[model samples]
Target: MLDNTKRQDIKVILQQVWGYEDFRYPQAEIINCLLNKQDTLVIMPTGGGKSLCFQLPALLQPGLTIVVSPLVALMENQVQQLQQKKIAAGLIHSQQAKSDRKLIISNLTQLKLLYVAPETLLTPPIWEKLLQPDLMINNLIIDEAHCIVQWGTTFRSSYTRLGVIRDALHKHKQNKITIAAFTATADTLTQQTIIKTLRLKKQFKKFVINPYRSNLQLKVKTVWTAKGRKKATLKFIQQQHNKSGLIYVRSRKASELLAKWLREQKLNTVAYHGGIINSKRRAIEQDWLTGKLPFVICTCAFGMGIDKSDCRWILHYHTPELLPEYLQEIGRSGRDNKPAIALALISEPTGWLDNEDKQRSQFFTNQLAKQSKQAKKVFEILPSQGNILDIIKEIPDSELALGILQNLDLIQWQDIFNYQKKSSNKNINSVSTSQQTKQMQQFLQTKQCRWQYILSAFSFIKEAKDFKCSKCDRCSLEKPSRIISNK
Candidate 1:
C-alpha cells in the first residue's frame, strides 16, 4: 500500500500531467502495485484508462520504463501523447531510421519511458543496449497483453520469448525489475496463456474488471448472401448518419471495396488496413479522430491506441474468427458512457461465405501443425549459426520456423532476421486453433441474449445470467420494436 505522502504525490502528478482530478477505479490500485515492484496483469476494457495505470507509475519511478507494444502506429501515438505533456519519451521501431534509433538508444538513460515493438526489442542491438551498466530499466510493460497469446504462437514469435527478458535484465541490474501486462480483452484461456508465456512471478497480481458495458447494445444479424450483408451494414450507417463509427472487415480488399461502396452511397469514409502506406494510414486516422470522416472501413489494424470516445456505433460486416477479437472491436463503441450499438452481419451457412471461413480456420490449424513438425526437424539439423537462406532451402516457411525456435529460446537473433542457435531442444508445442473458431461460430448462431453469450464466453457466468443489459437485440425483441438511435 502507498503511504500518505506518496499517495498525495500520485494525485498531484495525476492532476498536473493529465489534468484529471482523480484516478479511475482500479487505476490507482494498479499503479500502487507497480510502485511496490509487484508483477501485475490488468485486463481492462478498451478506453478504460489502461495506459494511465502504467504511464503514471513510469513518471513517478526513477528508472526508465520499457513498454513492449505490437504496432508502430500505437507506439508513435503514445510517444506523441506523452511528448504533448512534455514527458521525456522516445520510441524505436523498424520504420525508424537507423540514425534515429541510435540516437534514441544513446539517450535511453535520459528518458522516463521508451516504447518498442517486441521484434525490435529482441534484436541484438536493442537487447545489448538495455543490458548496459549505465541504463536503469525499472519495469517491462506489455501493452495489449492479449497479443502475446493471440500472435505469439503463430504470427510474431518474439512475444513468446518475452518470458526470458526479465531474467536477462536481472543479470545486469542490481535491483529486481517489475513486469505489467495490460489488455482490453482476454478470456480464461488467453489469461492463462499470458501468465504462462510471460512467466510472470508467482506473486503477480491480477486485476480483471468485467469488460461489459451496459451502455452498448449487442446484436447479430444473419444475412444469406454477401450483398445482403453489405446492404444491412449500409442501412446501419445511414441510420447513424453524422455520428462517428467503425466498420470492421476481415481483409484489405474488403475494406477498400466496402469503403468505395459506402462512398458511392454518399457517405464520407476511407479504407484503412496494414497494406496501406504509413503516411496514408496516419492521415485517415487523423481524419477520423477529428471527425472529418464520420466512419472508416478498416481491418483489425485500426483499433489499437485510438482514443475516440463518442464513436456511437460499430458494425461488423463479417463476424471475426474469434470471440475475443469481436469483443475488442465492438468495445470500441459507447466509450463515453453513452448509448451505442454493435451489430454483426454473419452469412448463413447456406452460402459459401461461412464455409470459406470455416475452411480458412481449418487450413491455418493444419498449416500450423505441419509447420511445427517441420520446424522441429529443421532445428535438429541446422548448424549453430548459419544464413537464413540455408534453413529456408531445407524447410518451407523457414522464417516462421526460425521464429518459433527463437521464441523457445533455442536461438537468438543477431540482427533483424539473422539467428544464432543457443540450444538444441526439440520439444515443440502445437496450439489448438479450432476451439476459438468453434466458439465464434457458436456465438453467431446462438439464439440466447447476445450480451449474455459474450459474458459467458469470457467466463463471467454469474453476471451473464443475472444481468441481461436489456439493450441487446434479444432483450429488445422481447419488447416492442424500436429503432436504435444516438442518445
Candidate 2:
C-alpha cells in the first residue's frame, strides 16, 4: 500500500520499530554502498551513526549480516539494542550458553543480523559452515575493521584471518555478498589496510568522514607522580558528576584500586575493566546503561562495544601505544552530541612498557621491511610521492607490503585506493616516521593542550581551532575544588 514494491525494509524498520524517522549522515551512503554490492571501508567518527550503515542495509538485503566484532562487550551491547527494537539479531561468542548458541544458529537461517567475534569466525568448523551457499549470509560487516590493518596500534591477531574467511565466503556465494568494513580511527596508512586485509577487490568503495567534533574541550597535563594523577582525576570527576564521565588507566588492578579509592571519598562510582569476572562486568555495564551509575573508572578494555550515548567526560591516565587506540578511547565520550571534555593524564611512566616504546618503531620498521621485501629500500625517500609499483620493486607484492604499511600507519592512499608499487629510493625513513610517532609521546611529555593534538591527528582540525576553550587544565591551574559541587 505504501509503495512497498520499491521501498527499503530498513526505512520501515527504523520508523515502525526503532521509532526513528530519518537516517544520519553517511547512513544512506553506506547502505547504498552495500546495495550496490561493493566492498566498502567506512571511517565515520564516533557517534556518527555507523551502525545504521550496516543495519539498514542488512535489513534491505537478502540474507544474514554476519558481523565480526572486536570485543565481547560490544556484542552484548549491540545484541540488546537490536532485541529492544524487536529486530532479529543473534550472537556467536564464547560467552553464549551452548544451548543458546545452538538455538541462535538453528534460527540463524532466518536471522537478519548475526554478530560474532572475528576470532570465532576464523575457526575451521565456522569456516566450513559459512561455505554453505544456501545459508544466505548476504553481508559481512567487520566493526572496528581497523584492527585488521597494521596502521592501528591495538592490533588483534584474530583480524588477520578475515582474508581467509572472506575467500571461503566467496567460494559459495549463490547471491553476491557485500563486505562492509567500519572504524572510527584511521590515518592514510590505515585507510589502505581496511580493504587489503579483508582481501576485498582492489577497487573498494570508501566513506570517510572528517574526524572532528567542535563541541569537546581538549586538555593535557604533565604530572610526575601517581598521587598527582589521583588528585587531578578526582577533582575533575567531582566537578562533572551530574553528567557522565570516565577515567582510564593501564592495569585492571589500577581500575579496581581507583574505583575503591573514589568511593572512599564518597562518590557515586563503579569500576569497569577486563580483570573483573564477566558477570560483574555485565552488571557494571548494565548499571551504567540504566543510568544507575554516574561515573566509571576503567582500563583500555572498556568501551569496545559500548552504545552509551551520554558520556560527557573522558580522561586518559597515560598515552597509549598508538593513535588509533587514543581515538577509540576519546570516541566513547560525548555520544549524545552535547559539549564534553576529554583529558589525557600524562606522566613519564617507568617500567617495561616505556622501554617497549623506545624500540617499538625499529621493531615495526624491520618487520614491515621484511614483509615488503622489494619496497624495503624504497621507503627511505621522504615526502616523495609516487606510485605503488615504483616503491614495490624492492618489496614486490602490493598486498603484503600494503598489509605491513597499514599496520605501521605510514601512508594512506587516494580514494578508490589501490596498493601500488612506489619508485626506487635510497633508504627507508623508519627514524623519521618514528619521530612523527613521537607526536603522541610528546603529548605525554608536554604540558600543552593535549586534546587539540589528539583530535587533530584524526583530522579533527576545526574542533581544535578557535582556541581559548577556557575549560582545560591550562585554563584552571590554581582553581579551587570546583570538581565537586559545581555540576
Candidate 3:
C-alpha cells in the first residue's frame, strides 16, 4: 500500500544509501508495513536482506528508530555499517566510553537508528530518555527475535520485560510506535512465542519467507570414536584449506583446546568466546573478516551480526541442541549468494564410542533443572508484588527467577522495575530444552533430504513435501560418504 511518492522516495534512498537497485522478495512490502505504522513480524533467512526492510522504513519516517539487539558486537557492527553509509546511527553498549554514550543520549534526535542491547535498554538513563515527552520515536525493532523465546526464560531476563515498551512508549495518543521483530530462523511455535511475548498487535503484519537457502549445501558426517571425531574435524578443515569459515564448538574450554590443537596442526585459527576480553574478541572478528585468519574455533558467541560475504563453509564440532540454532549458525556462510557447505559431525548412531554430544546434552539438561529449582524456590519466597532491584539484593538469582515466572505467566511485570505475582496452576517445566536437544539428535539421524527436513522443521511443510534437494548428500548419490570410521 505504499503510494507512488513514498515508494519512489524509498527506492531513491535504497540506491543512494545501500546501492541496491530493488528490494528483495518481501523487503518492499515489509518496509511499507512499517511506514504505515503497523507492527510486523518478519522471518527471513540470514542473507535475505532483513535489515534493509526496517532500515529503509526508518529513513522514510519522521522520527528515530530504536533497534533492540542481543549482542554488543551485533549492535556495534550494525551502527558502524550505517555510519559508513553516512547515516546517523548510534549504539549504546557497555564498551562505549561514558562521554560517548552521554553525547549520543543528548543528541538522540539527530540519529536515524539507535541500536541497544535489551538489558541496556532498561537502564535508568536510557529508559528515562525514551520515556521523555519531547522525543519523537517511530519504530522499536527486535532483531534476533527468536532469542526472546529461547533465552528470555533463562539468562537474558530483560527480553521478557520488553512487552512493557509498547505500552510505555505509546502512552501518548499522537505518538504511535510501531514494533517489528526480525529473525533468520524460527519455527511455528517460536513465531507464536515471539508474537505473544513481544505483545505484537493482533493485526500485526506477519511475513514468513520460507527459510530455504538453496545455495548452502547441508551435510552431516558420523564419527564412531572421540579420536575419529577429532580426525574428521581436522580433515574437513584441511579440505577447506585457506577458505574463510567458522568451526563451531559447544564450550569455551573446547574452543580453547580445539583452537590450540588446530594451531599445532598449522591451521590459521584462534579461540573465540564470551570469556575473552572485548578488544581481543574484536581483533579476532576483524582478522576473520579480513581473511587473515581462515577460520576460528568458536562457541556460538561469534557471527551474530558479522558480514563476511564470502565465508565459504561452516563446520560444527559439536551438534547444536536445537534446530533453529543449527539453522542460524550455518546461515553464516555464502552471504554473497555463492555456493557454501555446512558440515556437522555427530557420534555414530549408538553414541557408545563417541559421546561428546551426549555429555553436552546431559550437562545442559542438568544445568536447566538446577536453575529451575533455584528459580522456583526464589518464587516461593518472593512477595506478591516487589521491586526487582530490592528483590535482587535479598535473593540470589532472583532476576532469573523473575524471568522464569514472567515467562510462565506466573508473574506480570507492572513496569520495568516492578512485578505482580499471578496465580498459576501448573508448575514450570524444564524439560523443554531436553526435548529440543532430542530434535537435533533426530535431525542428525534422519535419512531424508537434510534441506527438506529443515524446511519441514521450520514449518514450510508444503515445500518440504516432495522436496528432494539434489544438492544434499542423500539425494546426490555420486558423492561418497564422508563418515569417519572408528577403524
State which candidate has the highest lDDT. Answer: 3
**Estimated TM-score per prediction?**
0.89, 0.76, 0.96
Global local distance difference test of model 3: 0.86
Question: Which stretches of model 3 miss by more than 4 angstroms?
Answer: 478-487
The sequence of per-residue lDDT tens digits that candidate 2 reaches over residues 325-378 is 777788888888788888886654563323423354455556544545533433
Better of 1 and 2 by lDDT: 1
RMSD of each: 4.3, 8.6, 4.2
User: What digit string (tens of lDDT, one per residue) describes model 3 on residues 1-487?
Assistant: 8789878889899999999898878888898899888999999888888888898888878879999999888888888899999888999988888999999999898889999999899888788898777778999999999999878976898999988887877775267899999999889889988888888999999998877777788999988998888899989988886898999999999999999988888777899999999999999999999889999999988998798999999999897788999999999999998999999998887678887778888888887888788878987898999988899899989898888888778899887888999877758764257667777887888888887788788887767777766777877764423321111
The 0-to-1 C-alpha lDDT of every candidate, in the order given, reads 0.83, 0.67, 0.86
Q: For model 3, where is the 10-residue window of minimal lDDT? A: 478-487
- lDDT per residue as tens, model 1, 393-463: 76666666776776566777654445688864447754356789889888888877777787788887766
> What lDDT score is found at residue 482 in candidate 1?
26
